[model samples]
Target: MPHSERPSKRLAVVTGANAGLGFETARGLVYQNYRVVIAARSEHKGRAAVEALLKDCPEADVRFEALDLSRLASVRDFAAALRERETALDVLVNNAGIMALPQRELTEEGFERQLGVNYLGHFLLTSELLPLLTAAGAPRVVQLSSLAHRGGRIDFDDLQGEKGYDPWRAYRQSKLAMLLFSQALQQHSDAESWGLDSLAAHPGLARTALFEHGVRSRALVGALFRLTLPIMTQSAAEGARPILHAATASDFRPGDYFGPGGFAETRGAPERARMSATACDAALAERLWQVSCELTGAMWREETTT
Candidate 1:
């Protein structure tokens, strides 16, 4: 049988898999016969999501694991748990993030909440799981980015947003970080022969819990989002297809971006996503990677399967 047609025992870890795009991604992977571990912040929701997936694909091999991306301790703990439970991990989907909040908030590690959870947390987690990923031979890492990254400007000095804070800027910076970091990681993987495929993607406008949270935080923006979401957004399942493609596609190209190809790249089939010129800055990505290492105390260079 062809490799794609053969049954796969590959194990995958998808963060924020309790709902929305993450849940859909997990469901799709499980349907492909991949053993999926749904990493969610809420165990109840995680189990619920697994049950839902089972309902859709009763034969799917899926389970839930607890993870809180806003906390570095949580990231470490979650990774440690995975190490105890499994020897190798084939795919990791960094698909959980927050959008524009009404006010500035900090994560458990004192970094800006959005940046901490969306980029730094995932960064630490990925580094922590490098050993497992490498042990799995051919592995893939998919970072969830966003269209907001086009307008994002990383303020190196105020990375924590101590001086001033803008919700959109913070969210965009985190998303842009995901984009840059994925590309940089792919380059590093090639240099080290890590046998890892790193990719990034956006979901355009998807009808997911993300906007529900965004609306709750800021009523005015929420109203506008509510007004426009029905007309512009696609289903959560449709939005997750980009991530599913990045993870399951046989081509295995690193840094390949994917998203919807319809109007404004919002509501169509999965394809190459658009990004800003800044998203291609290797130097900036390196700097951000360095700073992330400093902040999270996760030294990716030290990671090895042996």
Candidate 2:
């Protein structure tokens, strides 16, 4: 249990907080005095992460909760348990994700693996937790997008990648969906007066386990990526800066996207990142939102949007 549960302290839930960028983000939040819930799939990893967090900050208010984003039931169960314990949720960083799989895969629900874990799971999780988010006077939700989104296109006809599949293509599409969802959610918040702030951010080539997990060792592409990674990429702690900024900064507007500000957006400090024309397409965003509701059976305001 966290040492302090002061009412004045804001509570934050960071998905994938067991390691990498998510862990760094959680640490940053704790430093700022926010009580954090480290959401992850593995109990061992989650508990170890909590202990590591305490080791760094003995007074830190942080704990682990089981949340496997690969399964919809787990997402719901995680949210339900959280709602039972906390009346309001101040921040939600949809940071959990898996990278490119060498072979195409599907989630238990039969959705494309990348799309299922990266976008759909977070979409449903956000929907289920909307009530708690709204209960707070002002709440923020941050979606982790990627530079890969620039190369992504929403292939509605092959969203599940059943017709054809390319590892990087599927991964790109999922990230693009995340960016689109972030915008659409902000628009809905504005139109419906939900009083929620929705934002998106990218890490700009952060050095993390994602590269190791996503790429094949013998693959030439993976080799090249690794060779250039140290030169082009920043550390995971640096990567989490933009996400933290979006989650806690007072000057950001709803729907703003942030990333590293150095050359090519590879490193430095937080700055407004560029958005692809497709990412800025309002019509495309709305269409994707409707499709996501249908895919996940996630209802907004107790009802799915048409």
lDDT of 1 by residue, 11-111 (tens): 99999999999988998898888999999899889999999998998888898888999999999898877876677789999999888876899998798
Candidate 2 matches the true fold with a TM-score of: 0.95
Candidate 1 residue spans exceeding 4 A from truth: 1-8, 215-227, 301-306
Please write out the lDDT profile of model 2 over residues 1-306, one tens digit for every residue. 212343778999999999999999999999999999999999999999999999999999999999988899999899878876887889999999988887889898999999999999999999998877887879999999999999999999999999998888998999999999999999999998889999999998888899566766338877887788877889999999999999999989899999999989988799999999999999999999999999898887622222
RMSDs, each prediction? 3.9, 3.2
Q: Would you list the C-alpha lDDT of every candidate in the order shown? A: 0.87, 0.91
Give the best candidate by lDDT.
2
